[model samples]
Target: MPRKLLILIADGMGDYPAQELDGRTPLQAARTPNMDAAAAQGTVGTCRTIPSGMPAGSDIANMAIMGYAPKRYHTGRGPIEAAAQGLDCAPSDLIYRLNLCTVSELSPSGLMLDHSGGHIQNEEALNLLQVLRTELDTDQVQIIPGFQYRHLLKHTDGVGTLEAGLDLVPPHDILNTPLAPALEVYARSPLLDSMIHRAHSILTSAWNQTQANAIWPWGQGPPLALPSFAHTFGLRGAVISAVDLIKGLGRAAGMDVLDVPGATGLVDTNYQGKVQAALNFLEHGDFVFVHLEGPDECGHAGDLDCKIQAIERFDEHIVGPVMLDLARMEGAVCMACDHLTPVGVRTHTTEPVPFCFLDSRQIQSGAHEGFSEAAAAAGDVHLEAGHLLLPYLLDRMQEADG
Candidate 1:
């Protein structure tokens, strides 16, 4: 008879005012009747998920949102993604995010053209990763394939606690920037440096056919361990996300990581499938954390219309349906973004993003009319740190056992 909870995360849903939209953020402009209804009947406010001066990557931000202090638990995005791919790593293994990127050159330093390499398909990406493995992988290294442009490269015996401190930069953060400065970090390790150079040679030859000419390695870290969600929060939890990082978070938290067919983690992802997955998990789980990556993808692409469309689609296909299903259950619901991925910057911001939570049995009045950056800013109930918000959210639930 424990109270149930639903946590919905629209990745990078927060944004700044758009000049073309008359100063309205995408969420402010989207037709989110369902989210609006939740905001109007719930407690809404802003919360800073990413700690100050952090990389602002989804890995760090989401760790905070999931109630694990990023400062303590976060090793790097690479290790989390490795966990999601079910890749076993020793404590001394150096894990990196191997993105199939487009570069202008294959020299020691080149211009990073596209982090996603036109959002290459999974089949093609896998093929390219295999080629990399053949050309680069040795007894000391392993190349693992993941969805779309995301992949992994692991260097065994290269990431002891001391070696894990490599200051690598995420390729997405340096779009249109030179790669030399970033590549210099690997120079410390002769093997890794040579691998990058050789990988470039192999990629340059295949550029004409693949559009992906290079593998950008970043987010290096050693193996990691996290406290289980059940142990920390006293709830059996499940997580639904198309992205490996979120799935990794779920696995680290000892939550059920569900895989929904047709989930692409893009603007055209399987929204309905995710909603259904959430429903299925919530049927027996004490908590369900649902995450969608479409809005964040569009924001990173700087496509205003697509971002708005993604937000609208999330409302119609995911939020609306889940809310309807939750209506018949005795549970509480909460919705929020992990961090702000402003379309202008085309990257994650450390600003405080907004959130809204409501009790199913007693809907509070005087709540904001809708969920948006502006609306949440005006409302009360701000949490200074994002990790604290989850516990606060659970405290609002109406107890069925009572």
Candidate 2:
């Protein structure tokens, strides 16, 4: 049997802000004993959230993290999300992941939701999606379920000409500059508006039915695909995430989603469950990807204290457990993030993210600190993230077998 290789991915995990508000960087404040311990026992390097000169989103950044070049691996967004929903797609189908979001009709908003869908619970999101499904009578339209705060819809009959892209303006004022200008132009699509209206109707009906007020879905339309880890490594992979886009990304890459409960795309997530699920895949010589969405969420939310708590919880609950599990396994362990989401500066940043690897073998640690950004910058392993880790893993596995 091939060795069991475990990988832990902290999505949007690279940003450890320097002296932002509380004087201590987020990572420095975070109680990441497991991660810090792993670094002490292994290799530490400086890696980017994605490669230099690319737009950072889970869609593309994940591809790079998982060993695929975005240019070659991107298939479009819809098909990717479909995979996590246990839906299949052909290469030609223009699939997009739909975020059932709540957008404010107020000043200077980019039509994006704070939560994937206003932090709506699955029961609520699912119910509203069901209503939207019923309302959409178009022959080409298809509605698919995304775990929580997300849904998958597609124009099956190939509406390539009229397809409104999912990269619409967000409802976030913080992310205003990029999305607003684009949403301003694209929101005019009658097809997009039709979906939004139906979603609105379902939300209204839902509010009436449940007697609970919630933010309605705002962003509609499909996204194009990016390359997945599966296509690149020639190894089957599974990525479990609370975020629809991450699952959508796994789907786009031709992977399956492990059903996890209470998987809100928040920091207070079930990290242990994810660790176990990834270890479960050891029976097959494949990769297991587990994504945590919180640190970034807190970062974007500008709640530094919350971000610290999440990271500490991750270290205590998730990272520590994963390290222990991988220690028992035969293959080496790899860890990294999708991008740097800084506290109080929630958007993706270009700064170098820290990566550490652990296994039974000896690793070359070149003067990098065992934790945080400043510490990581001091170490010897500073370079492009995607280019190094994947190939290095392939080489390591090959060498072990040899």
The estimated TM-scores of all candidates read: 0.95, 0.81
Instruction: Report the lDDT tens digits of candidate 2 across residue range 1-402.
Output: 244566677766666556754566777767787788777777777766465665666666776666667666555545556655656654444555566555443223533336455466778767766666777746766777666655666666443545534344333323423235544444666665566655555565525454222222233333445455566666777878787667766666667667677666688777777777777876674777778877777766667778778778767877777777664666577666667777655677766677777765544453344577666677667767665567776676676565
lDDT of 1 by residue, 1-402 (tens): 435788888899899999999989999999999899999888889888988778788999888988988888888888999989878888878888888888888554567777887788988888788778887888887888888999888878876544467787787787767777777777876776788778878877735377888787789887668998999999998889889999998997889999999888887888888877777777787888889898898888888999999889888987788778775777778888888888988888888998888777767675678889888899888888879988887766634344
Clashing pairs in 1: none
Count of clashes, each model: 0, 27
C-alpha lDDT of residue 328 in model 1: 77
Which candidate's TM-score is highest?
Answer: 1
